[model samples]
Target: MIVAEKKPIEEIIDQVKDFQKLLIAGCNECVTVCEAGGKKEVGILASALRMYFMNEGKKVEIDEVTLERQCDHEYLEEIRDRIDKYDAVLSLACGVGVQFMAEKYFSTPVFPGVNTCFMGAAEERGVWSERCQACGQCILGETAGICPISRCAKRLLNGPCGGSTKGKCEISKDLDCAWQLILDRLKELDRLDDYEKIMPIKDWSTERAGGPRKVVREDVRL
Candidate 1:
């Protein structure tokens, strides 16, 4: 899932302070699971903004709403009827969601309330770790299940960098070496021979280097 963290309240306050009416929008998808931008979080933010404005001797009208997903046009259209009611919208969804909303409501000022982190998994309660960088070229088949592109500090493709010490990364002892993890997994699977095979240089054009990407599945098209 896409992981995100809430932006500082001070930063958010600075963005919407001049507006008399504001809308705090949340998402019920990835942000909800990450405990960053959800229905509960929207209410909390709305309350905080209201209290701040009240304390400043200003009257601010704030509304809270959570969409099933801000990334989807169907969910975003739900607010079309009343979008003009607000001076600005504070979106608590990922960057993609915020951008989508901005594009959908071009006249409205859309502000991001959370910083999109990365595509990752929940390691434990309240702890999320990066798992994939969406590099477009997947090599997990030969590297066991561990991803060298995302897990490696240097994004090494073939083997561990010389900087690695023991099983830990050279950048930080707290970090595990991606190559080490890959080797261990391959050994367990009795596919260590795969490691000896050299991987060709990755074609990065398939990634962001080629600019924004889109998929066209003719079978799924309406």
Candidate 2:
């Protein structure tokens, strides 16, 4: 899932301080699972903002709302009727969600409440680790399910570079060498022979090199 972290409260306040009426919008998806932005977090942020305004001797109207998803057009429409009631909206969703919301409500200002990190997985409670870069080209089929592109410090296609020592990456002892993991997994699957076949240079054109991407599935289109 897309991982995100909360931005500093001071920064958030800075963005919406000029507006007397503010809406704190949260998401019920990835940010919810990560504890950064959700219904619970929306309430917490609302309370904190109210306290700040109260302490400043200023009266502010802040509303809290958590949508099923800010990225989807259907969910975003839920707020259309009352959206203009607020001076601005503080979106506590992923960057994608924030942009989507802003696009839908082009006239209203939408500020990000969280810093989008990356596509990652939760290793444990409160601990999320980066797993994929979404390079557009998936090479996991040949790498024993270990992604060298995302985990490797060097992003080497065929590697366990000389920098690796004792199955650890040169960048950090705690970091396992991605290629080493692949080699071990391959050995277990008795597919070590596949390692001898060198992969061709990757076609990066399919990735960000081509700029923003879009998927068009004719069969799925209504």
Candidate 3:
């Protein structure tokens, strides 16, 4: 899941202070899971903003709406008719969702209300750890399901590097050595021999190197 953190209220207030009519849009997907920009968060933010404006003796019209997702056209279309009513929109979705909203509603100014953190998994409630970098080519099969690209501080392909000691990364005592975890997993799977085979140099083009990417399924197209 993509994890995000809400921006400081001060920064958000500064961005929409000039707009008399404002919309606080939320997403019901990943942001909801991460507790950043969901329906509840939208309400919290709206209330805070309302209190701030009221105390300041300023009049600002702030409305709240939570969409199933802000990254899809169908979900975004739900607000098309009402979008023009607001001077600006504060999207509490991920960076992708904010950009999608901006692109779809080109007339309205779209501002991101959260900082897109990373593709990660929940370690515990309110805690998420990075797991994938979307490097185009996956090597998890060879590494026994642990991702070195995201976990390794150096992004080492064949590693533990000389910097790892006692299964801990030299960079930090709290950080586990990703390669060590791979080796242990490989041993447990009786696939330790696979470790000897050198991995080929990764072609980074499959990643963000080639600009915007598109995945097409011709079979699914109308």
Candidate 4:
């Protein structure tokens, strides 16, 4: 899932301080699980903003709403009738959702409420770890399910670079060497032979380096 962290209240206040009316929008998906932007978080933010305005001797109208997903057009359209009622919208969705809302509305000012981190998984409650970089070219098949691209400090295709020591990355003893993990995984799977095969230079054009990407599915299109 896409991981994100909430912005500081002071930073958020600075962004929407001039607006008399504001809408705090949250998502029910990834941000919800991560405890950053969700129905509960929206209410909390709304309360904080309300208190801030009240203490500043200013009157502000703050509304809170959580969409099933802010990225989807269908969910976004739900606010169309009342979107103009607010001076600005603080979106608690991922960067994608914030951009989508900005594009869809065009005229209304949209602000991000959270910092989009990366595509990752929760290692445990309150702890999320990076898992994939979405490099477009997947090489997990030969690496025994360990992703060297995202896990490696240098994104090395084939390595346990000389920098690794005691199964840890050179960058940090706390960090495990991605290649070491892969080697161990392969050995357990009895596929250590696959590790000997070197990977060709990756075609990065398939990634974001090529620019914004899109997929077209003729079968699913109208």
- Regions of candidate 2 where Cα sits further than 4 Å from its true position: none
Clash counts for the predictions, in order: 0, 0, 0, 0
Model 1 lDDT tens row, 85-111: 999999999999999999999999999
lDDT of 4 by residue, 1-222 (tens): 999999999999999999988999999999999999999999999999998899999999999999999989999999999999999999999999999999999999999999999999999999998999998888889888999989999999976789999999999998999999999989999998998898888899978989988989999999
Q: Report clash pairs, candidate 1.
A: none
- Deviation (Å) of 57 in candidate 4: 0.9
Model 4 has an lDDT value of 0.93
Extract clashing residue pairs from model 3. none
lDDT of 2: 0.94
lDDT of 3 at 182: 93
Output the TM-score of candidate 4.
0.98
Q: In terms of TM-score, which candidate is stronger, 2 or 3? A: 2
Encode model 3's per-residue lDDT on 1-222: one tens digit a residue. 899999999999999998989999999999999999999999999999999999999999999999999999999999999999999999999999999999999999999999999999999987898999998889898899999999999888875799999999999998899999999999999999988898888888888997877889999999
Q: Lowest summed-lDDT stretch of 10 residues in model 4?
A: 135-144
Worst 10 residues of 1 by lDDT: 134-143
lDDT of 2 at 201: 91
- TM-scores across all candidates? 0.98, 0.97, 0.96, 0.98
The lDDT leader among the candidates is 1
TM-score of 3: 0.96
